[model samples]
Target: MNEALTLISFGENGWGDEIAKGVIVTVTLALATLPFGLILGFIIALAKKSQEPSLRMAANIYTTIFRGLPELLTLFLVYFGVQIGLQQLLKLMGFDVYIEVNSFVAGMVALALVFSSYASEAFLSAFRGIPQGQYEGGYALGLSHAKTMRLIVLPQLIRLALPALGNLWLILLKETSLVSVIGLSDLVRQSGIAARVTKEPFLFFGIACLIYLVLAIISSSGLSSIERWSKRGDATR
Candidate 1:
């Protein structure tokens, strides 16, 4: 018991600080990516539902390419490929600037792209599920397109998309583990380091598993609350 306690202690000898910092990084990456992902997803969903054939086709291609690629490959493309491309562009422009894409930024861009692709389908479905009458009625009532969307359509769209978005959020949380491959020092990487140094593979890996499970549980609880809140107004109607 003492040995296990010592392993998780916060002092210089323990890996507690490193593990805690890793958890923070993992959470930060997810949070930072989420809003941008959702916004891009909303735009893609709108594009897919647009009257223009070209817009629909473009959105389709965007979703198909990102969703079909492996998440790790996307990360590699963003981290290594993008950095190389940027440096080359700078050289071509006669600027001697060497641009470095940090792991956090790369992870954010890659994951956000993936999330937007997947979430676009959910948003498209929600948008289509909304009745055409609502659009007509809003216009009939002198509501501008922007005001109609904000006051009427947005609520229903969010309500319809909540469950799918919650599932996506859970998936996104787990997928953050992949960022460790690009040297983000996230939870899995920190655990691997501790295990390697202490030669306690099972112990450290087990701790990592427990940490992930705890995070999942907490996220699930929060999502459940959001889902319930989202439905409350509709339930009364």
Candidate 2:
């Protein structure tokens, strides 16, 4: 216990401060991106299910394009390509704006794009699994389609997608490491910094792993609570 506490001490030489800051940034990134990705995923999923062939094809293309590419390539494309694209657009507008995309923003956008692609599949499948009779019943009760989706479909979809979402959260966490390639000072990046400074990969990397484990455990427990709450009404069944 003493040894462990000593390891976590906030001395000038210790990595405690860096690890804490990294964890905060990582959690912030994850939480901020998760909701946005879910919204985008739902939209894409709805698009995929639409009767319009064009809309459905567009969504299908978006999912396939994102999901098929390597995450590393996706990060690079978003990071540099978006910047270049912005610059070109600005040039066309006769504005000399030196647009520098924020690392946090770029990382979130890249991760969200990938997350939404995968999440759309899970969410769409969940929505499909819901009995058609439920929607009919909802219509019979005078609920608007939007109201039925909001009050009925979404709840069930979220409950059903919780497990996949949890797994995606973990994947997102690991993928954050790749953002280090784009110069985001995430956990892995910070750990590399520490290693360079301390010349002790063992200590810094070990601490980083522990931090990731803690974050995963905390996320999993929170998701478990969400799962429980979502299913509370069906406990009797």
Candidate 3:
């Protein structure tokens, strides 16, 4: 017990600071990618429901390929592939500088890919859940489809997607640990370093677990609140 207490202490050898930093990095990376991912997801969901066959096919292929691929593989493709592609573009312009993609960017991109896959599905379901007659009524009232979606369908869709998106956010936090594999010193990686230095695998790994559990609880509570709010307005309907 004393050893366990000493291991987590905030003195010169403790991992309290490192773990805190890790949590920050993880959360920041998740937030950084969420807006972009959500936009991409909504667009893909639009495509999936598109009137055009070509557009629907494109969306189907994209979602299938991305969802089928292993996340680590996708991470490699995004980080290294994007870096290489950018470098080639620079090279074509006769620029000689090396382009570096940091772990934070890589992690965000990877997690965003996952986020978009699930978010697209959620949005698609939300889109279908809207009554067909609502669209017809809007059209009868001379409202454009775009306007109808914007004013009527979308508000409810946002409410419906909120809970699923919240759950996705929790997964996003956990998946940030994968960034450590790409050489990011996120929470898991930081704990790993301390474990190596102290030769105490159990201590560091256990601390990582505790951090994960605490984060999970906090995230779950947040999602529950959001879910309640989203459902609150539905009580009478």
Which candidate's TM-score is highest? 1
Which runs of model 1 end up more than 4 angstroms from their true locations?
Answer: none
**Candidate 2 to truth, TM:** 0.93
lDDT for 110 in candidate 2 is: 89
Backbone clash numbers for all candidates listed: 0, 0, 0
TM-score: model 3 vs. ground truth: 0.91
Best first by lDDT, ranked: 1, 2, 3
Per-residue C-alpha lDDT of model 1 across residues 1-237, encoded as one tens digit per residue: 888889988998898998999899988999999999999999999999899999999999999999999999999999999989999998999988878899999999999999999999999989989999999999999999999999999999999998899889888988999999989999989999999999988988888899889998999999889888888876453
Give the per-residue lDDT of model 2 (tens digit) for 38-130.
Answer: 899989999998999999999999999999999889888989999999999999999988888888888899889999999999888887889
Per-residue error for 15 in candidate 1, Å, reads: 0.9
* Local accuracy by lDDT, each model: 0.92, 0.86, 0.85
- Give candidate 3 regions above 4 Å deviation: 140-142
**Of the pair 1 and 3, which is ahead by lDDT?**
1
Q: Give the distance in Å from residue 201's predicted Cα in candidate 1 to where it truly belongs.
A: 1.5
